[model samples]
Target: MTRRAVFAGWWVVAGAFLCMLTGYAVAYSFAAFFGALESEFGARRGEISLVFSISAFLYFLLGFPAGLIADRTGPRPVVVGGLLLIALGLVAAAQADTLWQVYAGYGLGVGLGIGFSYVPSVAAVQRWFVRRRGTASGIAVAGIGVGTLVGAPVAHWLIAAIGWRHTYLVLAAVAVAGALLSGWLVRPGPERYGLTPDGDPPLPSGASTMPAGLGLGEAVRSGPFWSIYAGALLMSFGLFVPFVHLAPYASDVGLGEGFGVLLIVLLGVGSTVGRFLFASVTGWIGRRLSFALMYVGAAAMLVLWSQSTSAPALVAFALLFGAFYGGFVAIAPSLAADYFGGRALGSVIGALYSGVAFGALLGSPVAGYAYDFFQSYTGAILAGAALCLVSFAITLAMPEPARWLAARRPGP
Candidate 1:
C-alpha cells in the first residue's frame, strides 16, 4: 500500500486555523460575557456593545500594519507579539474594577492582538496555495466559525460554573499557547520548502524568486479595489450585529432565558458548515458569484430575523444568516488574492480589510442605539438588510477574477 505524502502547506493552514480559533474564541466569546460585563459595570446596552465594537475596530484597523510587518519580517514574530497582547488584555480585563479598565484591557488588547495575528496568518495561507486557494482559505478561516461555535457555549458554561473573571484567566492561558504554536507553524511562503504552491514541482534555481502580483499601493488604486472595498464597508455595517445581538434578540422575541447559548451555537454550527461548503464548491460556481450570493442571502436572512417571533423561525434565521455570513468572510481574502495576485498579498488583504474594520466599529453600536431608542430591534435589523443589499449591488458590478487578472497592469 502506498501512502500519499502530506503537503507541508496544510501544516501552515493548520497553524492559521489554530491562531484564528484561539483569537476569535476570545473575540466571539464576549457574547457569553455580555450579561456579566453589563451587570458588573451597571452599563446600558449601547455602552456594553461598545466593548466589542472598540475591539473589532482596533483589530481590523491594525491588520494592515500587521500584514505589512509580517510581509517584511515574517508572520511568526508578528503573531507572537499579537497573541501576547491578547493574553495581557485578558489578564488585565479579569482584574478590572471598572468598565473603562475593561475597555483598555479587552478592547485595546484583544483588538490589537487579533489585528497583528489574524490577517497575517490567513494571508499566509493564501501564499501557500493556487489551485486550492479557495478551499484552503475556507478551511483556514473555518477556525473562526469553529471558535465561535465552541467559544461562546464554553464561555457561558465557564462563566456559570467558575465565573467570568476566572474564565478570562483560562482564556489568557490559551492565548499564550496559541501564540507559541501559531508562531511555529506560520512560515511566509512555499518557496523555502523546495516546492511550489499546492506542492507542485520546484521552480528552476534561476527562476524568479519574487512572487507574481501587485503592490499594496497599486492594488488600492484599481477599479475592482473600490468596488470590493465599498461592498465590504457596506456589508460590514450589518455584519457584526448578529454575533453581538442574536442572544438578546432571541430573548426579546420570547424564546426565554438560557436560549442565548443555543442561538450562538446555531450561528457557529451554520458558519462552520458554510465555510467548508461554500469554499469547497467555489471551483464549480466561481468565487465572485458565490460572494455576491453571500451578500444577497445574508440580507434576506436578516429580514427573516426581523419578522421571526417563533423558535423554529429564529432557528432558521440563525442558521441561514450564519451560513451566508460565514461564506462572505471565508471567501473575502481568497477573492482579493484572485483580484490582486500574490505579491505583497498580505498588505493588499490588509488594506481591503480597513473597510471591514471601520464598518464593524459602527455595526453593533448602531443596533444597540436603535434598540434603545425604538424599544424594538426591527428597525436596526431591516437597516442591516438594506446595507447588505447595497453591498450586493456593488459586488454585482465588479468583473470576474479571471478577466480582472488578464487586464491587470503588469510588473508590480
Candidate 2:
C-alpha cells in the first residue's frame, strides 16, 4: 500500500468512528435528557425512564440480526439504513404529543437504529487490520467517547436554548450528515481492495479459499465465550452509575449541579485520552497485562469513589475511571475476535453485548433506588465497586487465544 492507501484506511476508520459516535450520542446521552423530559412534559421519573429503557432493550435485541445481515449483505448498507432510522425516529419524537408517542418514535425506532450500527463498523475495522487489530479497534471505538463528550454538553445547551422538541430536530440534522459520511467512507471486506491492514500477500491466482473459524452457535458453546460474556456483564453492571448520579452526588456534597455537569465533561476527556493512549499502549504491553492492569485500576478507583467528597477527589476519580472504562470498551470486540475468529464475529459479539445490557439495566435503577432508600450513594458506589472487582477476577479466568494457531482450531 502507498501513502495514499494508508491515509484512505485512516479515513475509513474516522468515518466508522463518526457513525458510532452519532449512534452513542443519541443512545447514551438520554441521561442528560431525562430530567428535562420529565419537567417539560409533566411525566414521572418511571415514565421518562421507560422510553430510554425500552430503547436500550431494542438496541441490544436487534443487534444479532444486524450482525447477521452485515455478515451476508455488507456493513455500509446496514449502517446507512440505521442512520436513516435514527433521523426519522428523532423527527417523529419531535412531533410527539403524548409520552407513548415518544416511546414509539424514540424508544423503538432509535433503539433499533443504534443496534444496527455497531457490528458493521466493528466488522469493517476487523476486516482492515491483522497485526494492529487491537489498536485499530481502540481508535474506532474511541469515537463513542468523543461523541459523548460533545453530545452531553451540546444537548444541555440545546435543551436550555430551544427546549427538547427543537433540540431533537437539530440532532436529526446531525444524524443525516453522519449517515451520508458513513456510506461514503465505509466498504465491505478488505480482501476486495487487493491488500490487508499490515500489507499481506493476496490469494494465489487460482485459489478461492477464505479463512475458516467458529460460527456464532459454535462459539457460544465454548467456555472462553462464556468467560468473555461474564466479564462484559460484570463490568457493564457498574459502568453508568457514576455518570448517572454524578450531579446529585455533587449536590449531596455541597457542590453546585454545574460542578457535577463539569465532572461528566472531565470523564469524557479522560475516556477520549484513554482510548487513544491504550490503543498504542497495547502494542507494547500485550493484551493480558494491559487488560488486567486496567480492570484492577478501575476497581481501585471505584473503591476510592466511595470515600470521595471534594471536587479534586471527584476529578481524580473521573480521570482514572474514564481511562479504564475506555480501555474496556476499545479492547472488547478485538478480544472477541482474538478468542474466536471472524466467522460469526458480528453475531457473537452482538450477543455478548446484549448480556451487557442486562447488567446496565440493573445497575442504573439499582443505583438510583439505593440512593433513595439509603439517603446516601455509599452503598451504590460499594456495589458498583464490587462488580468491578468481579470483572477483574473474570478477566483472569479468560484463556489467551494462541493467535494464528488458535485461529485454525475449533475452540480456544
Candidate 3:
C-alpha cells in the first residue's frame, strides 16, 4: 500500500504525545524533589519553590518565540532542539551544589526546553485534523496526565533509592532518547506530504485549501482574543497551585510520603479522564460552554479542598480538581484554533499561552509565601477558588469570534 493510503496524521499525534510525555514528566517531577531540595539546600519553602516558579515562567514566556520559529520552519527541528536542551538542563542541575546553580540549571534550562517542545508539538497536531481537532489535541495533551501519573511516583522512588541528583541524571537520559525518537517521527502539516488535512480529497483547482483566518496582528487587536487571554491568565493562577504545594501540604497534615505521591497519581488519573471526556463532548456543547463548566467545577473543588483536613477528603479533592484542571488544559489549543483559524496558529497560540507563564510565575511563589507567613494553606486555597470564579466569569463573557461565526454561515 502507498504511504498516503495510511493517514500520517496519527503518526504526528503519536510523536506529539511522546514529546509532551517526556517533557512534562520532567516538569511535574519537581514536586517529588521539593522536600529533598529543601533538606539539601537549607532553603525555606518560598525560596526553594521559586525554582519551579521561575522554570514555569520561562516555559510559558519562551513559547512565543518558539511558536514563531515553528510557524516559519516547522516543528521537527524545534522538538529536536528542545529535547537536547532538556537533557542538558538536567545534566547541569544534577551537578549543582547551590540554590542559584539549581535555578540556573533546572529552572531556566527545563523551562525553555519545554516551552520550545510544547507549543510547536500541539500546533502541528492541530493542523492535521480539522474535524477531530478537539479529540486529537485532547489525546496529545493527555500525555501530561500520563506523565504526571508515572513520573511523580517514579521520582519519589528514585529520590528515595538513589537521591534526587541521580534521578536527574536518569531523566536526562530519558529526555535524550525521547528527543531522538521524536525527531524520527514528527513532520509538518499534511501539505508537506502533498496531502490535505484530515486526508481530504484534492480540490479541483489543485490549489492550497488551508483556511486563512485572522493574522496575528488582527487577532491581537480583537476583543475576543483579550477575553480568552484574560481567562487563561486567571485560570492559570490557580491551576498549578496544587501541583506545586499539595505534596508538602499533605506532609504537614500528617499524611506520609506514600500517600502524598498517591494523591498526585490520583490527580493524574482524573486529568486523563477529564481531558478525553470533555474533548469528546465539545462537538455537542461547544468549546466555550464546556470550558466554562470546567471552571465552575474547578472552583467548587477548590472550595472543598480548602475545608479538607483528612486523607479521604483530600483524595476526593485531588481527583475532582485534577479532572477539571485537565479539561481546561486540553481545550485551550482547540479553542485558539476555533477562534483564530489555522493560519498563524503557532504564533497566536503561543502568544495566548504566555498568560500561563505570568499566572504560574505568580501563583507558586505567592502560595509559598502565604504558607510560610500564615503556616496554613487555607488562605492560598481560598485565593485559588476566588481566581477560578473570576476566570469562569471571564470565560462566560467570551463570545465566538466574529470571524469564526461568519465562516459558519451558508454562502449567499
lDDT for each residue of candidate 1 in 1-412, tens digit (9 for 90 to 100): 9998899889999999999999998999988988898789898888888999999998888888998998898888998899989999999999999999988989999999999999999999998898888889999999999988988899999999999999999999999999999888888787765568888766676342335888888888899888888898988888899888888777777775468668888888889899988997788889888899999999999999889889898889888888888898899999998888888988888888888988899989889988888888888889889989999998989999888877754765
The TM-score obtained by model 2 is 0.90
**Backbone collision tally, model 3:** 0
How high a TM-score does candidate 1 get?
Answer: 0.96
- Poorest lDDT segment (10 consecutive residues) of candidate 2: 204-213
- lDDT per residue (tens digit) for residues 35-102 in model 2: 67767689654466567666666676677788889888878899999988999999999899988999
lDDT of 1 at 30: 86
- What's the TM-score of each model vs. the native? 0.96, 0.90, 0.96
lDDT of 2: 0.76
CA-lDDT, candidates in order? 0.88, 0.76, 0.87
lDDT of 3 at 52: 88
